[model samples]
Every structure is written in structure tokens, then in C-alpha cells.
Target chain A: MNASLFDILTIWLQRPNFIAFIILFLWGLYIMIAHHNLIKKLIGMYLVQTSVIFFFITVSAKAGATVPILLNGESVDPALYANPLPHVLMLTAIVVGVATLGVSLALVVAIYRQYGSLDEEVILKQLGE
Target chain B: MRHHLPVFVFLLPFGMAICMPLISLVRPKWCRGLTMLALAAMTGLSVMLYSHVIAQGPIRYALSGWMPPLGIEWIVDGLSGLLLPLLGSLALMGVWYAGPLVTEGKGSIHFHLLTLLLVSGLSGMVMAGDLFNIFVFLEVSALSSYALVGSAGGRALVSAFRYLILGTLGASLYLLGVGYFYAVTGTLNMTDLADRLPDLLASKAVMAGFIFMLIGLGIKMALVPLHGWLPDAYVDAPDSVSPLLAPLVTKVALYAVVRVMYWVVGGEEVGETLPILTLSSWLGAVAALVGAFLALSQQELKRMFAYAGISHVGIIVMGVCLGNPTGFAGGIFYLLTDAVMQAALFYIAGTAFYSLGIRTLADLGRLRGQMPWVIGVLIVIAISMIGIPPSGGFFGKWYIILGALEAGNYIVVGGVVGATLLTLGYFVTIFERIFVDSVSSGPAVLAESPLSMRATMGMLAAASLVLGLMSDPMIRLILDHAFPG
Candidate 1:
């Protein structure tokens, strides 16, 4: 339940990517759970997913490294290039996020067509459940 | 060719999935035949793969001859080898039962297409040796299953939407956890992670990472306190989809937990830094109790079975968390047998919905004498679920309870055994309503389920029976493949 000053400072300032990820994740979780409108809930989901994508990109970053490309005329030093695995992994994550958004949005459309409302309480009321 | 069986399990279905749209274009009718051929091949390939794994040990195939720590990898050990055949056959049976119910509506091809994709995703999840690859396959399976659940339209759409939110949340958390571990170990391969995790287990970041994965897969597995999406999804899913989604969706998540945590992280025994195992076993206990009690109050059969599923998942996880070979084997045994039994039960549920319009518990009273011999199969399955001897469910629980006793975890012991009595209460209530209680309304004569439907259900029920009666060899098979080298 308690942390040292070093831990606090690390969380607040040093680990920019992790701190930002935590904030965005909790914010999005709030919007997704507390919002009544289905569209807003989906927006919240997007924020959470984007936060994850950012975190992965953070993992791939290095201060003095070039892009993960091989130079035709130069010998390769791995440390000169930023890690590409995390970046490549994020591309797949981004596609999956978009695909899920599409599916959820289609479901929202179907719900609206059936019940004429996007508000959770309103739809549940209409269903009398 | 036999050596390629592991990759073939995933690629066959994926290739068939891509070919589906084209087949529908050239000849819509051929879609069904193509689907049957694809799954039959997948199942056959998996059976061969299982034998190979048993004989030759775990198979790890590196893509393009690149060895693990850098390139993508796929591994099928004892546990995954057993599950592949079971899930493949479930898909095969699911298609046969779904044959009559799948309407020739516009884009009927979507049904078969999504089914194949789901199977492919599931197989990929089972075999994936890379953490990020597992996440990708998890999404593929989740996305396809969403479309399948919402395929019935209307209320099903609403349920699917809610599941989407929770499912995406779960995936993001899982990815975050993977990132945390990668940060610590600088690797994503399971074998590499295991080698690095022991020393890092005491680090706060690694502990947090473990909790994140637990929460993430918890949502996916529909554990108690995080199961808000499951019952609604199951009840509202199309009858055709339930047979596939109900049995495999949560079961696979449970498998991921066992594979990653115990198989990779070395369970609680390997790392003494945290009592995360004990903590999870308690959570499983709570889930078992809460799920059973809620199931007791359900008036609809599908809804009841959904709650019961939550309880069984809890029991299986509890077994695995015991950190012993007997318990792990029991968990695997229950998982394989339960997939077959749940698939068969959902088929009967679909039959009732499609033909008899029997949705409520009261509607079962009319099935007294007029019902086809399918009632006999239902009795067999219900008895197994009730944990009677000579049935799969009984032996599964027996090993779990025995393991719990050995570990002195009385709470888990109570939860596992107490659920059996509650299970009896529900099954007896259903039977009493069917054969004993007098019907108040409904039709006097009942329509019979098709021979194909009846035949599939009978086969699965018999499999459950055989799984229990023949527990010795099967348990030995599981132990040999899944445990110490």
C-alpha cells in the first residue's frame, strides 16, 4: 500500500509510456462502463486499444537508433536500429482493433434497427428486462 | 506430411475460410460440401498429430527454418495435442447439427465462413508458441464468434455488442501484460520467457504482469465476478452457434491459463515469490458456488446450462491450480469431455428451440412420452453432468476433489463437492418436470429431432460415458503428454 519516493517519481515522470497507458486505460474503461450510449462505449474501447498500441510503440523506441531497415552499403550493428518486433506486433494489434470496432459498430447498427435506440437503459426498458 | 500436421490444423481451416467466398460465388451450394471436407480433413490431421505427439514428444516447428527466440514458432505439446482433436471433432459435429437450422438467408456463406475462421483461430491459439501470436489468434477467434452469436439478429445483437466491449478490454489487458513480460525478459517465446521468469518473478513489474494476464484471461474464460458477458451471450446466441461457442470459447481460455501459467511460468511450485495460485484457487471456489446457485434459479434450460458451464470452468481451473499432476490431468480430462458433452447438450437445446418451441423449464413437462428416443441421450448427459459414476463428469470431479483433499484446501473441496448436489437438484427437477409432473398446457404430441441431430448427440453422450469408464488409459495418456519430460 505504500511506495518510496523513487517509485512515485518513476511512475509519474520516468515511465512516460506506462503512465500514459495507465491513464488512458482507466479513462477508457470508465467511458465504456459508465456511458449509456453504445457509440460512446465504442469510443471508450477505441481509446483503450489506442493506449495499448502506444505502449507497444513505446517498447520499440530507442534514443539513438535508426529505423529497422538494412542499409545496402553499410555493415549492420543491431544496436544502431530500434527493436522492430514490437512495432511489427503493433501492426497486427491495430488491424485486430479496427476489425473488432467494425464488428461492434455493425452490432450497434443492428440494435438500433431493432429497438430504435442506442441508450442502454432505453433499450433494456424497451425489452422490459 | 504427418510432420506438418500441427500447422495443417490451422492452415487447412484458414485456407478453406478464404476459399469460402469464392465457392459461394462459383456455386453457393458447394460451400457446405467444402466446409465438410475442410473440417473432416482437419479432424483427421489432428488425430494423426495426437498420435505423433504421444509417440514422438512435443513438436516445435519454426517458420522458414528460423529457430525460436526470434522467428515465429508453433508448438503442440501433450495438452494441446489432445485438445486439437477434441475441438476439431466438436466443429465437425457442430456443422452436422447446424445443417438444418442454418437458413438460406442472404449471405448464408457467412455462417460457414465464420465457423471455419473460429476453428482456425482456436487451433492457432492452442499451438502458438509466441505470446503476441497467441493474442492475435485470440482476437481472430473472438471476432468470428461475435458475428456468429449476433447472426440470429435482434436481441442477440445487443448481447454480442456487450460481449464485444468486454472481449476487447480483455485482449488489451492481455497485450499490456505481454508487453510487461517482454519488457522484463526481452523475449516473447514461451520457452524463452520461462527461462527468464524465475529470477524476475520477485520483481513488482513481473508480478503486475502476471495479475494482468490473469485478469485478461479471466474475462475471456468467464470466471466469476467477470462473467457479466457470458450468460447473456450464451442465452441469446443462435441455437446453431451455441454448440460451437458454448463449449470451446471459455474452455480454450482456461487452456491458455494452464498452458501459460503452469506450463510456462511453472505454476505456484516453481516460483515461491507469490501465493497467486492459492489466491486463484479461492477465486475458482467462489465461481463454482456462485455459478451453481445462480443456475439453480434459472427457468430456461439454455440459461441454466450457461450458468452450469461457469461452474464447471471454475472446477477445471481449480484442479489445475492445485499444482500437481493428478489435478492437471483431471483438468484436461474434464475439459476434453465437457467440450463434447456441452456441444451435444446445446444441440438438443437447439432442437427444442427449432422444433418444440420449448424455451422454459415448464415446457419440458410435455416431453414425457411423446418425445423421441433423444430423451434417452439427454438422460445420459444429464446423469454425467450430475457426476454419476461411469460418466466423464464424475471422474473429472473425483480427481479434482482428491487433489483438493491432498492439498488441504477444504474450501475448494467443498465448492467442488457441493456443486454436485446442486447439479443433482437441477437435473432431478428437469426430469421430474418431464416424466413426473403433469403438463398444464402445450401440445400433446412432440415433433422428433432429425436422425442426424439425434445421432450426433448420441455419439457425444456415449463419448462422455466412455471417457469416464475408460479413465485409466486416458488419464495416463494425458499425464504422459502434458507433464514432466
Candidate 2:
């Protein structure tokens, strides 16, 4: 309610949100670039994807907000809650993301059976120069 | 009830795909026949849907009676309507071409089942109005495509795996974009998100959304620099599978871009105000020329077609990036014509490979005098690719040029012209070998193609010619009412 605490809260909100998003983004990128195993790379990609979800959830938050459900037969105040829509969308995204991972893993398994290795470098070598 | 064609566009294939696996219980032959019938039915329904949309304007059907912005919806304007028929016709033709080949491979019932799922997924991707729903079907198409690609065994398995890795990255990026859009606008429905995005135009999350979505769709569309997966996937995929996968899968991905760009992103309205407008258009132009150059250099017949497919995608995107209605319609028309012609061309290529055992263009010289019928089919398809008269390819290129000129974007026009000329160059090489010279028959003489194969090629070649003549109504339908500017 007061200016001093409000200023502190806003600063706190912006910094941590920004920091969390950056860390997740970098971590996901690292796995994608560094992991050589096809399945591990896929897992890394999914982790990178989850990091983005983390970014969405964090940025969508409001300071001092409660959960976004109707409680005690009363409509909750908008200012006191993070939006539920993004969270719901993220859930759907997570489902799709997982499904994609499953498919990719299935392909990887098939690849291993055929090529006898999951290393990206080796597969490319076998394919051609 | 006719206003609800959008729902049927998706549901018909979906319902049929669910039941296709069970057909194995009756008999393998029965399964193939039933699958063919289902795809044919889908084709007929889509043509009807196209006519309906042309007459009545875009048909919007909210899922389960819930309104959009609150629930998922399906939109079938000229764009989706145009795409539905293209998807259906290609699937039907591909199945017809593939049926015998599967028997040749002695593939199991799962082969037909995966193909059905691929069709359902592609149809759903085109018709879906919600961003996340598109992702669901996108995965369906991608997963099934992976299986279809790998079913050839040996080297195809590696190619499919590589495609899977790249494809998963693309999907992840797309999901990342969706997350960003949700963070900014709190909705995944394209129409609602478009309406809401303006309010968050300056938000960092929205910027991230634009980048993520563009990169993701670019990978799926197999644009330049992101197209590493295409050649192998198309080349190593079975002779039966390449035509279906190459023509429709990437085209559908491009359709997704158009949907997000024009309808969902509000085209010029959002582009002029956005950060990525200039960059996206520039990337499209670059892809057009680069893809063409890559295509011109390939010696393998199927790989050449794959590169040509990417080049055409670049041209379509170039037309799109012009940000005008004519440009949009031209892009859509190119999409339709390209899918038809490319599939037909690939089908002929596969036929040659099957009948002659010739995989490289250099080796094709051996079949020069041996296969007149196949050579004639190739000439027709090649003429279309070269944008010669009396072919749909010419009209597609004309509109793209017209759009670039309308926008005063000479660079894009130049790219289109160069790609067209390159198209002529590569296809002409094949033509000269086919007709201008003769080769002595080898120990393994060429065999005449079966009636089924000949009938399919003749039908596709005929459709290419007829589609060229039918452009007047098709152009007006997509350009006039579907997107009123």
C-alpha cells in the first residue's frame, strides 16, 4: 500500500523473474548443444521447453497475488491473483511437449536398433561426410 | 449444418483413423481397400467444403457449441478451405500410389494405420484455429511421418531419427513460443490472441513468442539453414512414402505460418507495428534463392525434388511477407499448386526408380529410350515446375511476381525469377536426356509400368493441367471473400 514497500516489492518481482528465466533458457540451450546422445539431447530439449514454461509462469505472476480460483462463493480480486489462463495454457503445452518427447524417443529407439549408436556425431558419419 | 464444414474437415479423418487399425483383423487386402475408400471420401468432402467456403465465405465452427476466446474453434476460410482439399487430394493420391508399393515391401497393417493418422494430423493442423491444438496435430503428423520414413528399413531408419531430433527441437521451440504468448496474453486461441496481442505489443515476452514461433515453424517448413533434415528424409524414405510426405507435410507447415501470419497475427496491421516484420520477409527471400540453388546442384532425383520443394516454400513465404491481400492469395495458390505438382513429380520419380532401378539423374540416361511412357509423364510435371504455359506453376509464379511488384519489392521479384529459371534449368536437363538422346538397353532392361501406377501418374498430370485452367475461380475464391481487405 505504501510507496517504499511497493517499490521494494516491484524491484524484487522484476529481478528474480528475469533471473529465473535467463537461467532456465541457458540451461536448456546448454543441454541441446552439449549432449551427444540422441535421447539425452531430446530430454535436454524438453528440459529447455520446461524452462520456457517457467519463464511464462514467473512473468505472469502478480505481486502478493493469491491463486486464481473462485473461493468461499466469492469472486477473487484480480489484483490479488496471478492469471489462471497462462497456467492452463502451459498445462496444455506441457502435454504436447511430453507427447513430442515420447515420439522423438520412439524414433531414437528405432534409430539405435538400426544404427547401433545414439551419438549424433556417429550417426552423421554413417549417413555421409 | 453446412456452416460446420470446419468440424467435419477434421473429424472425418480422425474418426476414420481411429478405426483403420482394426481393419487388420478382417484381412490385409480389406484394410488397404478400406483405407483407400476413407481417403477418397475425405477428398470428396474437402472439395465440397472448398466450394461451400467459396460461396458462403469462411465457415467458423466453435467446438461443442462453446464460443471462441473461451473455447477452441475451427476456422475454414479460403485459406483453410483451400488447404483442406489440397491435403485430401494428395493423401488420396498418395495412398493410391502407395498401396501396391506397401505390398511390395510386405509392410504390416501398421503401415496403413500410420498413413491414416498422418492424413488426420495434417487435415487437423490446417483446420485448427487454436495455437495449441495445432501443436497436438503437428505432433501427430510428425510422429507418424517418422514411422513412415523409417518403415523402409536400413538407411531410412537413420534418416528418420535425424528428422526426429530436428523435428523435436522445432516442436520445442514452437511450444516455447506458445508459452510466451500465454505469458503475455493468457490465451492460445489464434483469434483471441491476435485481438489481445496489440495490448502487449511492447512486452518482452511477446517478442520472445515471435522469435520462438518463427524459428519453430521455419524448421518444420524446412526453410534454408533449417532444412538439413529434408533431403535425407525425402531421399531415404521409401519410394511409396516420399511423394506423400514431401508435398503435404511441409506445405501444411507453411499453411500454419500463413494462418499465424495473416489471420492470427493480423497480417499488415501487426507487421507494421511489430519488430520481426522486415526480418521475416528478408529471410523468406533469401530462402527462395538459396533453396533453388541447392536444388539445382543435387544429382539424386528425389533429393532434387526435396530441394525444389524448399525453394517453392521460400517463394510462398516471400509472397506472404509482402503483407497485401493479393500476395496472400498468391502464396495460398502457390501452396495448392505446388503440393499437387510436387507430389505428382515425386510419384513419377519413384515410378522410374521402381521400374528402372535408377536413383541418380546421371544413371537416368540409361532409361532414355527404354521408358517413353514414364518420360512423357516426367515432361508434363517438369513443364509445370518450369512455370511454362498451360500449367498451374506458371500462374503461381505470376501472382507471386505481381505481388512483389505491387509491394515495390524488386528483390523478392528477382528471387522468384531466379528460382523459376533454375527450375527450368534442372528440369530441362532431365527432359533433354529423356527425349533428345538414346541409350542402349542394359542387361537389366526396363519393364513397363503397371496399370495402377500409370493411372495414378496420368491422373496427377491431368490434375496439374486442369488446376492451371481452373485458377480463375480458385484465385477469386481465396483472394476476394476469404480474406476481404
| Most TM-score-accurate candidate | 1
Interface Cα RMSD, each model = 0.8, 2.3
Candidate with top lDDT is 1
What digit string (tens of lDDT, one per residue) describes model 1 on residues A1-129? 599998888778987877888899889999998999999999999999999888888887889888756579775688788888889888889999999999998999999999999999999998776
* TM-score (C-alpha) between model 2 and the true structure: 0.92
Q: What is the lDDT of residue B217 in candidate 1?
A: 91
Off by over 4 Å in 2: A1-13, A60-72, A75-82, B104-106, B199-204, B274-278, B436-439, B443-446
DockQ, computed on Cα atoms, for candidate 1: 0.88
Local error of candidate 1 at B283, Å? Answer: 1.2
Which candidate tops DockQ? 1
B120-187: candidate 2 lDDT, tens digit per residue = 99988988889888887898899899889988877888788778778877877887787778766767
The clash count of every prediction, one per candidate, is 0, 1
